[model samples]
Target chain A: MTHRTIKPAPNIVQGTPLDAKALKRGKIFLNSYAPALRYTWDTGEAMGRYLAELKNGRLIARSCRKCERVMIPPRMFCERCFRPTDDWVYVKATGTVNTFSLCYVSWDVRRLKQPEIPAVIEIDGASPGMGILHLVRKVAPKDVRIGMRVAAVWKPPAQRTGSITDIAYWMPINRRSQRTVSAK
Target chain B: MNERVAIIGVGVMAARPSSEHLSFKEMMFEAAQKAYADAGIDAHEVESFVTCAEDLTEGISIFDEYTPDQLGAVQKPMHTLTQDGLYGIADAVMQLRSGLVGLVVVEAHSKHSNLENPNSILNYALDPVYNRPLDFNPHVIAGLEMNGFLHATGITQAQCAQVVAKNRTHALKNIAAAYPMNLRAEDVQSSPYLCYPLRDAEMAKSADGCVVVVLAGASRAQPSKSRPVWIRGVGFTNDSPTLESRDWIDAQYIRAAAAMAYGQAGIKDPVAEIDLFEVDDAYAYKELQHLVALGIYPQAVAAGRAVENGESGAAGKMPVNVSGGSLGIGHTLEASGLYRLAEIVCQLRGEAGPRQLPRAKVGLAQSWRGVPTTSGAVVILGR
Candidate 1:
């Protein structure tokens, strides 16, 4: 039996002939039956709920039930022990910048966009090794490097909301004693 | 021991830029039917089907929508892999190894001519977080890899052009080949640069076509309708998705894949063991880089001597791209592997009219998924 081939009309109504072949600017129908992918934040819920605490100017982490290892960003499951986590410990908002890349492009291609530097920082008061992916502000793209000490600059208490973006990118925290000592 | 699968038949639809007369399914069925006819097996004879396909967003909705039934795969265990065509072939090899199924059909189609912006469509394959944000044209990744390949291997631009000239020359013998032209180093050099160090002429022209092959277990009674090319071995691998992460100097994925496949095929030296090759030259420079990865081209100014030996033609050392490869036959993405499979099977059967190789016993075909993911596969076919 012969299968009838399906062809759709040209999608791009305007454009110069692409090649010397003199072919019409057209569309082909692709029939895909693969199962669709659906995802839920099964593990991200604790991180989301803990991050919800940040709106009130508080940091929280989950302590592993078996290993007693602290997980930042409060995940529901512990990676090391392979067990569920329940201990919600509050911590301070001080951490060091782990690594970062200065991005100069935007998702939208139409407009000329400014440089945006997205960085991954390890939050203070959370587990020493735990890290979060966010942005860094008030620093030259070139000046950004690994191990740069930065502190979270939260919004006013009443204005605080449970979100990473609420911190408005970490700022360089200057140590006066270290600066003066280095000067001597 | 599980039964070894043998490709009992192979067929390819004539590749073209735009098949105004045929739909993608029609084109696929054309090749599938021809393969069934060649194998003397009806669609009902096959136990399952595997097709290589991408999202409908590339064309219209229902991507695997028109396959199966159209390819005569109705009511069987059919599955479509959203991967490169050759990977789908690798999947078939796995299915046959399980011993649950004896016969399987693998089909891949390319209707590139349908896309408005092929580059934009290609960008979707990149890491959404980093590479895609920069909106890197997929060719740039190849361009970067080619630069590293040339610098590390010392294969010169001229050698790259020679690869093109030889492949196109061999393609001239392929009736189904769409871009069979007698090219010269100067001709390729003069073509505009799509990306630095890569010329427009060097790139494989995208086309619309279908290629399908019918493979059955070796333990099954021989059909005798057509000679079978046993699947000696199959190898496929994917490299780091981030271009920044890998040592671009070598196509580690291709080398690793080749080793696994060559080992399984009991081939210690591909240059000596493989009688002919069907290299996936999506871009002319890719042939040089991939040859190096396959451990064939070892220098900057590679003695593309093997390519120019006239062996890849009708009679001439280890003919490569005798069906013209993607360079001459046009790269149909998913269908390209089947095209390579068809040529190898035909050559081994002494059925490649005018393009047949002399005393060809073994065939090797290698393909790389274009970019973002430096993924590739290598397969060795034996009679």
Candidate 2:
């Protein structure tokens, strides 16, 4: 048989579209409440250590002896092998871009004057595909690629805080780049 | 099993971009009233009720406290599922199969326009130390996953655009579809990018909506307004919640969920057995990746050929997202899966109008929890 009953129109339109003028007038406003909820998260044993190393200008990772997978932003246990990490390892500060996005807007939906190149950089010492979500800098947004090599541009030691932002942002290793002394 | 669950009636309402006409409670009431009336049953006959919603999406903590009043489910054996509406239906199926309840109603709704800061709200859902400090837009992860999925599957961005063109054009036939643009693959490519690879046009914009489905046991299936579509299989699973730890190539959770559902339905081959699919295509690339994950295509590489050859279209060999999907219709947060499920039920009952299939006996609906999480659900239904 051919089709019989077609479903009705999609939306349930009732009142007219509320314009900004009437909305701002607050004539029909019944209640007003702004939410402010706070939370305190324990960094746990693994992430707590990872943040401490970031504060000291180093990248930390953990290895699972069972499956031999190295993890960045280190974890206490291995997800696949189902075992606690067997060793602690420090991954290289420099890595390749696993993927990236040229964001024209901020998290709060505000358009940015300059687009931000946010990429997931796969740490050299971690597993082959494992990566961390962070920002890229010192390169034009158009020049960024999937496998581009980049190094972390850290904040000065005096200005460092125990946070992911301590690494300032990542910069592409261009031909004219100068070498910096390692933190021992 | 003793008996199968039946979906007798479904009610849904969605507005494009946003809905300024009605409040969230009013939206739920609209769907609830239609659903109950369609099922030829009243609110008093409903033994239990299941509502799907989340605290963060609604912006009001303990959101369920405000749900029951509108649905007329007050003081009954009512419960809530924080996940998608598919999960609520799955739970309701178990409740009815236990021979306890004769009638059950599952409800879910979305009010994203009211959210003050949706991005920050999503960021709060992320890990506090590693993810939040980067101040990343959640769409960036979708881009990253799109990269990994395509690189692993050898699917091109142009092919992904075909999915956008296919769905948006497919929406023209669906009256319920939200953003029905007359777009093509070139148009999708020419569109400005949202977060690299994932163009602003490809990602489904959130809209305000509600969905309610009435499920009655086979014994009580009589005295009904419409034919009951039996729930043949139901499955949902969780992969590693952390994106860093998951198999980023494809959705293992989807594979597992499909296996469970297909197993229950005695479906050895999905592409051959299932007539059509109504998956959560919140993003364009997701349709390609999910087809591979659901085992419709043997691997990700096979998806491109199918899409490019018009094999995944409404009249194609394997029709997918015929109700325009979330990309065509809007994604209604937790209610998305049920919205798709309702489409399948409508198609099986010969009620889908211009978008209906030639002959559909069995259909599948799949959904995934949005960004930074690897959890999904699947359900199968037939006439």
Candidate 3:
């Protein structure tokens, strides 16, 4: 189990970065491509209903009869119980923040003027720790904390578009309410 | 296991930042060509092929339909693994053990530089209805996970920054490393944040590369004059998909995968039996998390100390990522596993040049599919 005289070759190389301008100007010998890949995924039995509920300024989840757990951002099946969802339940609009980040980068990898506070909020009616990723706005990044109680602030019914954005953002549940109860 | 599987040959071609000379298909062909030559066999001799890729990364759906021709496996038994490079190699090892094939090829690569919107590509990987709509950089999850990891384990952010400093310093010896720098801990600690706890310097830069490994059964893989490296054990696992339900601090999937691989390898204590590691460090914090999961450290807090103490460096107790790893070497996405494996093979074969470990007998290669998922694979190699 030894290399008596094994030789090695370089695995990495320094290459000039491709210049798109050169390619566009016909100075480079390469082809250019732009992907227009698009798709409209079926929201399915659970999410279809979830989005519909969001448009009406309400939060919804599916109840798994087998496990007796409510999962938010609802799904058609109970992943743990391995069965189809048995019932639909409307969960509380407020949830506790499980984790959060002050993101200074945008979706396009650009720096942002204002850092976005994104957190995973576990809804009330959903099982404990059943959280969904969402933005928590109106609270200073330094003030956001794990286990903070936040409630969904929805857009006016006229502006609802059957999308997650229908809810403007999650706002910390009030200073007085935060001290009285733990995350449901 | 009735038979053994060995990596007979390895090939890697990396272009930092981008590859202007070759097309994606041509890149795959070039790496495959070198692997076939290294294996001392023609492309036709390789019975089956397993290619690693992701639809989102390639910006093409059904990438498999376009794979066979370049690898010279047209009309043969070729399948695809939508996983990291290490997972594909693990699958090839199983294929060899099944007795259905004497030889197999595992291929993976990252052509990320070609994507006009890599961040958007990553966003598509999130849970569509709930996660994708957040519209922030998909990397934000690393921050969340890092925050959780540090909070639960008491591993300080400064300690993680030390991981960055050490890895970048080690990368200096690696010609293939994209981020090799003469750096200090404070350099990374004071760097701009990508996600808190994850400084921009600590994050792996995207690099384009292809890796192909030729795997053969023990008998079929005779090393008449060359060295022989065998796959003693291989395993992969995926934890709960719900981010809320998982062990936020530890890499549970890595722990399971390492357990299975170590169990099969008959390894009792990794610190004593294993020679070195090339674990996933797509992010610096991940290196610590996976090490904790792999039993190198009893917990994250201890692992952080080991990192700060230089006990994990090449000259220390157990060397990790001596080939500079993905942090030093640019991360090659799906192909990262094979890149790590290639480094291990080079080390075990005693051909790793300046970074080669002395008297190294066994090595481990770890791979995580990256953020927004809780899946990972591990492979144990012994010579």
Candidate 4:
């Protein structure tokens, strides 16, 4: 779809940049407002049960009969199959690290002294490639690898809460053995 | 897809770290005025308007209510899409193609500097139950994805660094770019890791800017004084939003979007047919990842090697992000897609100034809604 060309027109690039001093000195009129909005999200049937299972030191997942894929963060319906999930299955706490990060910053961009190693752990009983996001702890950040095996470290029953945090974090399975041997 | 739609005019407020002097409305007005003038038509002539914005990012609920007055769109049919500006373009294109609207205006802007805790706002996008509770920073997702992508495709960290170096160097020639730099890939590699495997230098800093585009049906565009860039295809898609369910190694959303777009554009081979590209580079690795998803490269490793060998540079075989991309241009949030569209429009019209491609004809612009969201859009335009 070729057309007769007009000479390239000059672009209209307009914007005024300011420094911190400009705002501080009131050189530019500024209005500041902050909104504090609070929300209490409803954890639905699938996730509601999943969190409860976490509180009990177990991982729960839903299986899609149509696709035969077991999914975590269990949902009522299988998005791929467009069908309601058929059964709930308990997944093994031990899994391989599908991917991980050594996070040196907080959600608000605040620097942290100790890096948080967040990982996507593919639970053993779930379908291949299905994983949940959680922290991998008790191992040096440098030691974390994508394929390393890890198992969840759960809180004591007295301290159990219906939340993902009920499981403190995932630790390298090898490190768990080392700790057990050292304790013995 | 029924009738032809053409981009008659595009106006942009060059991206900056902050636009302290202009309010978002004022930026809109400025961009709209330029666009209307370039199109050689009054705002009154436009039949429909679409504004791309997110309420959380705007700090205003129902942000569409405030969009109309600024663009002379009062008492007109205007709606907002909580998506990237490329989606806005797609909306306008559909409106025009419907034969109901002869002309449409699309606008998207970023007031990113106004956000005090941008990362926290991004955190809100995560799944409240599963992911948000464990959130250190949402960018950890990027780190994990980069690591997974590298493992899956054998693309190295150094190759991703070269994407930063190439795009920043290209920004030097772009008058509208914000973070132009001339540095080696080592500079990016050595930069402190914000989330391990994802460095601070690899992420695009936020910028404030606005983009306005005017699109018209064949009847209106053929009679216009300005040259028109024809819209060949437009497509967008959203993959699974859940962290557990989605593909971490590739941008399935982008691939799906490109498939729909390339099919519509009759682009059997994107690498051979498209003259230039302005794909999302919110993060450096994203550039290579997107290239692979766009079907320009067979896989991430090939896309990575292409960057390493300077094959995607401004002067390379298939020039990608010659306009500096989000990396060098500063990420403008939702308006990013429009900024990419604006760059391609300028290049296709031979108006890119120093960064203009020599044989530009067909071009593609792609965008992704940043972290934790899998929504992405692609548009193809030909002169």
Candidate 5:
């Protein structure tokens, strides 16, 4: 292909410096210019309350009033229903791998120099369908298949927090024996 | 009442990834000016606004903060779609269809060069649960799709390379195209692999640019200085973002969108009805996948009948990617769709110098969001 050679026009405008060098320092400086953002959340609170249930080996979701659909990672409202959820429902922690990818790069070439395989898994239990975003470990990326059963692996009780990361990762659930290990 | 919506203006900036001089807003403003001038309308005349943006952490601190001032949309009804250019057009169309707004200005641009982890930012678009954890570069997904396309359709790598060569040749006439080079199939095949089966030349380089279009109602669409290419029909649909759940080889989302648009335009045979086409060739296989999906190429063509008959060019049945597409041009996110749209307008108005398809009366434009997501839109325009 013959690439177009662009000639810079004399009338082109300029802007404020992006501080390219300082950005490469990899450390925060005092009084560095950055934009401030303010956020509020009924959703955050719902997630907090829901994450609390996961530690006790339970999965919860919000059921919408208008559409009567359940939202995983429990939001206060349902997008499809366009209405507030009517009730909180508990779903099984087990699910199937919906889709996944094996990531080969790291941020700043940091820790875990090895790649990670991420996926979207649809949880099993409750109204027949709902998936949540989380990491899957203990199995090679190529060995994984869609619809393979998996279960949540929770962190130790002392390290528990009201967050999605509270579950260390999802491990392959042994369907042949229906065996699951309790939280570490 | 029938909706009278039309695109009354268009604008774009000279494309590049690391523009040393201008800010994102400056690039947008320059493009907006050209669109407004083409529409023969002032910025104040626009009743609503829809702008496309992505993560602010990628470049600016707040993503939406840079939109209003740049688009001249101060105090106007505006919404941000952190998606491709087609999404912005879809929003404007919906607002116009509701009889809620008459004149809407849509803006979309990308300034991705400043980000340190640009590849990671693209990966973030994947489903964080399964897809992102794998550390998969989204380009690999394109490879898989292309592999499937080749395996199923019997299309060779050389044929795919021909697409690149043809598109770049078409783009040589386009003033705004960033990488308009005369390339050969052998050269493209021998290039370094970004992802298996997809070489360096096959991928569209990240370029920073702005594209804006003024969409207006019927009365405002009356031709002034430049002919207004009417948007006859618009179609958009999204497939399961979960990649494993869908057929990666087939572009169902684009097919569905194209069906809706072609149906609305009363087009039963796209090959015969459409004159020119601008497909989302964000990846090499996408153009062929979309072509097959739209039924522009049927099973017989899939079996190599079309190539043997000397009917492979877009002008053979329907000329595709006449503006050289995102492949020859550049995929500046939201800017890409409007760039396709502008090319169609220019073609219909006989303004395209070398790329002007003879007797072009109608055109189709399509776009696909890159990876883990399959959101797409198709629009049919008429002179």
Candidate 6:
């Protein structure tokens, strides 16, 4: 049986569009309220250990005996293997950039005077492809590149706290040597 | 497989940047009323109801409580998915195919205009311990992924711009689209960069709208006023939420979701079997990335060339986002997938007045829950 085409009825959609100015000027009746919600997250066993090691100028990862993959921002279990992770592995404070972004806007969409370089650094001694998100600094934003080696810049021991911020930022390493080799 | 499901009715409120005159409930009521009328049935006939929304976005606790009244779903089996509308459709399809519900209704909406700071809300979606401390815009994730994807697949920045040019131009013919325009690849390339490699024009602006769809079992669907758009297959998947473990370059979530849908539909070759597609275009690069993941194009470079050559255009071999996609229609958050599904239904039923495709028998709709997450859903529809 051939069914005839079914068209939507006329004026089916009903909604009035308004601009930000009109909404602010009270051109339309409105009610506004802001909810203040607070949260306190518990950094679990693996993450707690990871953050603690960061304060001491070190990086730690958990290894899965089944997959033999060392993961950062350590988790208690291996998702792929569906088993509890086997051991804690200490990784180097230096690594290569897996990917990077030069952000020109703030979280609220406002343009920034200085672009922030956010990157995923694959830490040394961990399995390949395992990386953590962090900021890249101490170099021009344009100079940051994927696969470039970088070392962690840590805060003073007196100021150190159990947090990811214990390490100030990641900075490019062997820049002079890299430039000389490229020039050769 | 024992019973088939079909979409009997679809109703939508045309997307706009803001809808100050109507509350979310009013928007829901309007959409539901039109859908019921289109199906030639009343709300009471629907045995199950599913609404897609996030509590943070709605600014209300237990958002589903507000849904039942507007949809006339009071005292009915109703729940909310905190995911996109495509997931809601998948849920309804399962219910109908289970032989428990003869009729079902799925609804989703976006009141993004009400948000004073959407970025702040999106920030809460990040991992508190690992990612949230960075204090940067969540879209930087898109920027990072775009960089990785381009480097891995050899797709250029100019090719990404062509996506914006084609999708926006297509929106010019869609009355429901909010940001329709005639743009060139050069225009997008010259636009200010929000994040390096991700220009401001590349991202979709949020819009306010609601979509309500009425679905029924094979027996119940035959009596509807509108021609039934059969749900041949439905699939949804979520990859790792952690930034450390997930694949940054490839959209494995979309790949798995599409694989499940294709398998159920018995589709061997999606490029030839599907007539048209309305996939997610939350960002210009995402359209190309998703095309690669959908297996429609072999890789990002091939997808880019297809866009440049207009092979994905309205008249191309495989028409993609002919309804302007989220880029042109304005991203409707959770309602995005339903909007895409409604457009496909209109085309398959031959009711898409101006932007209709000729001999469109099969179509697909896909959606991704945007940034700071890896979750998506896919649905295939046939006439």
Assign candidate 2 its CAPRI class.
incorrect
What tens-digit string does per-residue lDDT give for candidate 3 at A95-142?
899999999999999999789998999988799888878999878888
lDDT of 6 by residue, B235-266 (tens): 89998868787798888899999999999999
Off by over 4 Å in 5: A1-184, B56-62, B224-226, B300-317
Which stretches in model 4 have alpha-carbon errors above 4 Å? A1-184
> Candidate 4 clashing pairs?
none
TM-score of every candidate's chain A = 0.66, 0.83, 0.81, 0.78, 0.70, 0.80
lDDT tens readout by residue for model 5, B220-244: 6777654777888888998876777
Off by over 4 Å in 6: A1-184
Better of 2 and 5 by lDDT: 2
- lDDT tens digits, residues B7-98, model 1? 88777888887775555655666787788888878777788888888863345445665576566666678888887777878888888888
DockQ of each: 0.01, 0.01, 0.01, 0.01, 0.01, 0.01
Model 5 reproduced share of reference interface contacts: 0.00
What's each prediction's TM-score? 0.65, 0.67, 0.67, 0.68, 0.65, 0.68
The residue-level lDDT of candidate 6 at A14 comes to 83
Error of 6 at A160 (Å): 52
Q: State, as a TM-score between 0 and 1, how close model 3 is to the true structure.
A: 0.67
Residue lDDT tens for model 2, B107-151: 998777676677777776777656666767977888988888888
lDDT of 5 at B324: 74
Q: If you assessed candidate 3 against the hidden native complex, which CAPRI class would it receive?
A: incorrect
What interface RMSD does every candidate have?
21.7, 20.1, 18.7, 19.3, 17.8, 19.4
Residue-by-residue lDDT tens digits, candidate 6, A124-164: 88899898899888788877889999878788777789888
